[model samples]
Target: MDVLADINEYLNPTTARWYANRGIPYRRGYLFYGPPGTGKTSLTFALAGVFGLDIHVVSLLEPTLTEEELGMLFTNLPARCIVLLEDIDTAGLIRVEAPEETTESDDKRDFNVGDLTKAFKKAKKLDEALIRPGRVDHQVPFSHASQTQIKELFERMYTDDLPTTKIVIAPDSQSDVLTPPMTPISVEFEKNGHGGEESELEDIARRFSKKVPENMFSPAEIQGFLLKRKTEPRKALEEVGEWVRGMEQVFKTA
Candidate 1:
């Protein structure tokens, strides 16, 4: 969130001018690295929605793609947009398969351009080149769901009537209410609710989280279970223990 906010501020028109004065290109880059199905792409889409900006996804592996075309694409992007570079590491530059070691020439061979971009690579130990300073300024890791994430997912699934307030983050001017903020709103579940029903729901989410071991399940797996028992919080709580055990067995067998 802090990163997003900082990005938001950096993308502000005022900040762009600030960059211009200093001869620094007005752009930002982030690398979301993790195993596949860890919500890396999902988070990118969410970010696009928040800022009401179009996402320009470019695949570097396209048969006809060239460095000139890549530069043209980046040069013509809108002031506020996300440029997603696909298959950034599929090339054998990292020498994962090839026995020959990569040299300095391979590093300069790839299309190099301005920032305000994002890239997703399915990796446990990601290549450092993908996230070296100005090229990709920030790196976000997405791993299996932890205990806290599991609890949050459980609460989000069962809570159906949550209200979302539009959050406006305008660094330049107060009247800049048009552009949306980083998140639509990160509704703090505990603080947003009141009364006994909310407490009961919180208690149920806690119980469900406890039943599922920490970081053992992907969020999608847990969400699948909750989706089947949607609007039946009590039923979900009751069946979660059995579901966790079954999942454990399935994983072990696999």
Candidate 2:
């Protein structure tokens, strides 16, 4: 389906008003499911950008995400915003057989399925209520990016128009060890200096883009790797293949 077009139609002002006039809930819910390394998160980001909406992502697996907290989160959301609940399946919703006997030691044990199920049910009820008319207008599910799309995404990660900084090495004649610069790199290049720096960044981005394989990694995986190498873009590009191989080996062994 043309997901973007469908979302646009659903978000139209007239569509919402029509639902209200019919005494129907105006909310919409979508479910996207796929294997790991898919573009589910990326699609959500794109949707938020298109709608000019702020996104609040909640991880169901978070230990602190209690039922009351979940309700508060929905209650306090802006009139028009995207609320994302990721990894819903892992949120402890599975059915479990309750233990016949209980002891003080049971309270000290990690949360079992019974406890999780109750919490999950409460959260689910809150979700249903929040999605009714006048709240949570649209829900969209994301899937993995295509091979071509994955390549493009990796390319953009490096080539996007982001602020660039230059590192200046100090001479060793004046000191026995390297000293920190008085000014931060961001402050030093607060204003435009020249086109040369931009061109250099673009070059680096291109080099990094070439190193990423098509459909080999998910957006999240690539992002995690880049965050580790944020201080050294060139190093990220140089070592991405090695890093990917190591991750694959670990997974294999596991």
Candidate No. with top lDDT: 1
Model 1 local distance difference test score: 0.67
Which RMSD does model 2 reach against the true structure? 13.0
Point out where model 1 deviates above 4 Å.
59-71, 86-128, 162-195
Best by TM-score: 1
Candidate 1 C-alpha lDDT tens digits along 66-154: 87987888789877888887666664334243324555533221122211122222122345665668787777766667778888998
lDDT of 2 by residue, 88-160 (tens): 7566654344555756544331221123223334323333454454554444334333345544554455453
TM-score of 1: 0.67
lDDT of 1 at 103: 59
